[model samples]
Target: MKTHTLLTVQEATALINAGKVMALAGDEALLRQLPKGNWIAGTIPYFIADEGGVESRERLYASELTQVGAADVEIKTYTLDTIKNIAADGPDNGYTIVILPARSAIHTEYANHGRDYEGMFIKPIVGWIAGVHLDDLNRAAPKVVDGSAGAVLAAEAVAMHVTLSADKMAVIHILNLFRQDPDADVITFAETGFSASTCLVNGKPAVLAEYLAAKRIDLKLPLVADYNGAQINTSFQGVDPDGRTVHFYAPVFPGIEYRQAAPVGDYVAELGALADGAHGGVQFSCNCILNYLYGELQGRKTGDLYGPATFGEVAYQLLNQTLVYLDVRSVS
Candidate 1:
């Protein structure tokens, strides 16, 4: 059975602290419950202590800011003390904590642990923590991967790892969806292994536009490209199916700089065709950061720290918004 509720960060943390959630070898039940939305995964590769520099470390966070839509993102900083407090106080305190690390400290710790070390470590680091809320614990638990429990270990086996800016991109995507459909339900799905060019819509093969159409939901698929490759118009699409006329607004990829090279109008039209049963939408997938860097670093790496963390944030936002969209009444 599919679990319909989303979980908040607070609820998830409590579950972890209480030992309500358990890790399994490829737990399908847990994987199935992840929230659904635009999933974006990234990583923070561990460079050799001597070779690693401050500028490179800063670039990781800086790259996140450069993603397509990140302007309205809300970034917060958290410390070990604050995390300990949340563990003690419970979810009512109401805040998500993201840890950012000091480059020098991370480097020194990496040296002590040895270049080939593989383990999860969290202590003085710089990062932000943020998330939306949902009612159920099951739904929220997957969004968080605890480094301490051997659940989300670092790829390079270091003790100090922190979140950078890609988290902001996840936030922006959720905010955009909320702006469009305040009541839409959010769902998150985390990938332990990266798959290429395959996306599942409601457990079926279909693109975003096609899924929207199959449901008979009257909405316009926004054009995202040019018809003749002449010019591009950036806008969001508006639809009123009953009138038989849908309006394609300009393309909007706010906060993100690398715009989709294709014209917005074209993409919208393709989406409409999918809705009309005339075509199928495109499939999309992403590579895991660990897998991408595996060859570059020659050593025994155990797990993916950055990829799972990114998945956790994306899943958190999707599940949070989904509960809001469904207007699920609170349970005592």
Candidate 2:
């Protein structure tokens, strides 16, 4: 009945040996000690567990897919070339769970172009970006393990394509606490990129970094774009040394309108309000590391919304500063 759980290496290994299919998250050292089985894991020491938000290297976070009505699953790894085929690789009537290592080439490529992959958004795709401990960011790299093949990959992505029973379907939800500030200027880019030198602010061409300086913008506030009714976020990484180019966690697309998000006061309370009634049929979930850090949620409770606090979230595409979850619903 638990959504995400904290377990010792022995506990997680035992679950796998028992033929339990799972998605695991933990420090690289801890995950490396587990035996191979029907499981896929990524490196991440942060989690929102039963007690609260906690970071640990001594245990693993496990999500048993079988416990949530996953009928059949196929685990596969993809490189940059094959990543685009992910949509075609999924179950026709089911959903997909993908994990990519942080700072890996495949991760960057997917973040920029994964949404355009043919057949995407057709089937529900949910997962998180594997990330290393903040302290080990410079020394150690993130990794994803394909338990089926006993492969530990760094430059690729591993995914679990799940097939639900005939009557069941997977539904995806995103909890975005921030909205477009109605008083803010509309911003647009001249080209699509993860980093930009120039942008149009309220229909006038302006230097990206200089423009931010003039407005005295809060770097913590992400650029929000409304895709139909869905708010997609592109988090600010930082400006270059010369303050000439601005970098973002997610790419900014040309032609799309964007605006700085409205300010948020208590992230925990606001996220809790958004999370109300969200736990009923959730099969899996993951939140952004920005939310974990910016919201100061290390010792706080976020209602029943719990999962790995990841570098990035996936809901058929890459997302930043957002919480994504998948629910299993029965259809007549």
Candidate 3:
């Protein structure tokens, strides 16, 4: 593990200004110190702003940023739309830059607003979202927002810029991890009886219930249960030939009523056996939702809204356990 030192606002700002990407600890203090005009993404506070304020734009100080979330450490901001305006369309690709609603103007307004206003107002303000575009993937021209617009406009600019940067970093991390394990198979399971329709596996595509019915087994099996461990009996559904779609009784896990079919213990054990060689191993990644569900099952709750830190801890535990199996295999 790398030792992480918390950086002050000025130091963080300077690092960002120097064009260095920062891996933040995802704490409230770090979120507040995030420099304006730089992109950042991690769990931050999210909330709706209260009406009534001084109507002045102000740069958020470290102290003010801490108090911005619904709870502590969460930064509540707005979702802004990214608009690309093309001036001249051609292979040249040179474009003009325009900031809509003007982020500076919005920040100024928020500063003007007195203590009566609660929460960060992020909306209505539109601007160019900033992030490193891999190749020509990001060819859109910069957006233009008039500075004289409302606070929402400026908030939008801030949100878009920060989100784009954060998203870019996330993509890079994911890709790097994938590169480290190119042949790893992606498995998915969907829970039945959810209003959302279908569940996705590894974010590739959704599996509908109707498709699973084709492979259905005529048996009254335990479908799912809620967090209370109450089992709901449902018809045993068939799985796809690829072993991806599984229709089973829903588990009592809260929020999710249906249980998606997952690989049985035997399958996992077999894979572990294969990777048992002295130098071989396996890597696994999962959606944070799974960690949240497990935490709920374990009755562990970290008040942090984003819950990335909690997920990280869970991941470490799982990884260590996987290594233990590999160690056994090597010795055998």
- Whole-model lDDT per candidate: 0.22, 0.88, 0.24
For model 2, residues 101-189, the per-residue Cα lDDT tens digits are 98788988898798899899998899999998899889999999998888898999999988887888888998898899889999999
TM-score of each: 0.18, 0.96, 0.25
The sequence of per-residue lDDT tens digits that candidate 1 reaches over residues 89-204 is: 21221112232221222222322222122211211111221111213222432222232432332221111111223222111111111122223322112221111122243344
Stretches of model 3 off by over 4 angstroms after superposition: 1-14, 23-25, 44-259, 263-289, 292-332
- lDDT score, candidate 1: 0.22
Q: Relative to the unseen true structure, what is the C-alpha lDDT of residue 211 in candidate 3, on a scale of 0 to 100?
A: 38
lDDT of 3 by residue, 1-332 (tens): 11122334565566546544222322333344455432333321111011111111121111111111212111123323222111111012111111222123332222223111322111111112211112322342212222112122224322211111111111100100001112222323343121223554344555544434543622222233222542222224345565554432121222343443232234223323432233322111111222222223123322211111111111101110111110001222
Task: Give the clash count for model 2.
Answer: 0
Sort by TM-score, top down from the best: 2, 3, 1
Worst lDDT 10-window in candidate 2: 64-73
